[model samples]
Target: MTLASSLLSAISGLRHAFFTREGGVSQGIYESLNAGIGSQDDPVHVAENRRRMAEAMGVAPADFLSLYQIHSPDAVIADRPWDTATRPRADAIVTRTPGLAIGVTAADCGPVLFADPRARVIGAAHAGWKGALTGVLEKTLDAMETLGSKRPDIAVAIGPLIRQRSYEVGAEFVTRFTETNPSYAGFFVPSERDGHAMFDLGGFIRMRLEHAGVETIDDTGIDTYSDERFFSYRRSVHRKEPDFGRHVHALVLEAD
Candidate 1:
């Protein structure tokens, strides 16, 4: 029900998981393990699903924190747990506080977990195209730095999301990126449809991380759009489904 990163799993006092939609009470499009508090799934089921995730991470259910996720470049520091009604509105969260499982929810957007084992600091970011373009990853790194994590010492794991082969975009979508920097054009290639291209979001994310001096990055390379194991917003849209489930990718600094 969960996927672990080899690099993150090797760490002594850190726990992380890329949860799948396999276990839960929600049915229909949100069938099981939909951790999104914002989703249309029944509140009771969502709570129970998240409770299971928190238990797996060895944290109290209330300690499993997630942001409101506005798809912005904002990152916040989580010094303590906050209830869903009072969760902060941001794209990323970083913390040195042990036992607090900071996480981010996503269906097609990138869910990146970061950690600096030596400093006992960890972070989670929701990087959709907008957040990624606006520098959410860099902002997350900066937040982690404030919590005593150095960029060079941090290892990042890119979890499940829609991949390039399943992602096609229009001319304006390509232009929005290339217009930012001409070199950004290489991240895309011609698609079968006219005035469209297949964009490599994972590659783009890696480039941003590398440019920011994060040398170690492990990508799960799982495409949500094609993978039946996870939910996909794009796939749901394609099928005209009302909504989709969201996977919660989290990281925790365990208490000694």
Candidate 2:
């Protein structure tokens, strides 16, 4: 199944989907629609799955783009498609190019889709805690602005990810956040385990976007860890699985 944001849906000339782990040819743990190019899944299977995704977005497979995603705060502007072997090493992608589907891959980390219909610019970011804290969201907005997108006019949608109730963090993790800004502590609450707390990743991502001057925001409120329909890194780890699949959340500006 594919999920979408109504706020983004209401806009014309935009196409996107927060694709779940469904409707593809991948097998085993990647059991369908796994778009992670870096995964251990068979390369042919991955390509076929991505082809289906590209078809769903009404773009050729070559026009569907994603990054290597090193969890950095970097955001790059995409004007043309690049080979998967040469995918840019960045966490976010912004583009004004129509018919080019730009996306980010994620399991438990947040996948944020952004669009400014007025400027016809769109962006996708992989917001793991580190990336979000280090400024990926702000960087994405900056890149969009370069393409004539106004921060206030950009509408953002936060996709499914590990929610607070299912995301437990160690003391060191909490310390890292609080040390960044004492107010960040508000995003965590005590967990049953001592020296650990549940982190609200979705809330933090939304807060970062809001601070970056984006006013129209929506969250899918789907938790990957607890939801079987989605793939999840944490859940895979907890289950002692070797690896997890990734979902591709993409956005495209349709051509006339």
Where is model 1 poorest over a 10-residue stretch in terms of lDDT? 23-32
lDDT score, candidate 1, position 79: 96
TM-score of each: 0.99, 0.99
lDDT of 1: 0.93
Residue-pair clashes, model 1: 0
Predicted candidate 2 versus true structure: per-residue lDDT over 84-161, tens digit per residue: 889999999999999999999999999999999888999999999999999999999999999999998999999999
Off by over 4 Å in 2: none
Task: Candidate 1: list runs displaced more than 4 Å.
Answer: none
Clashing pairs in 2: none
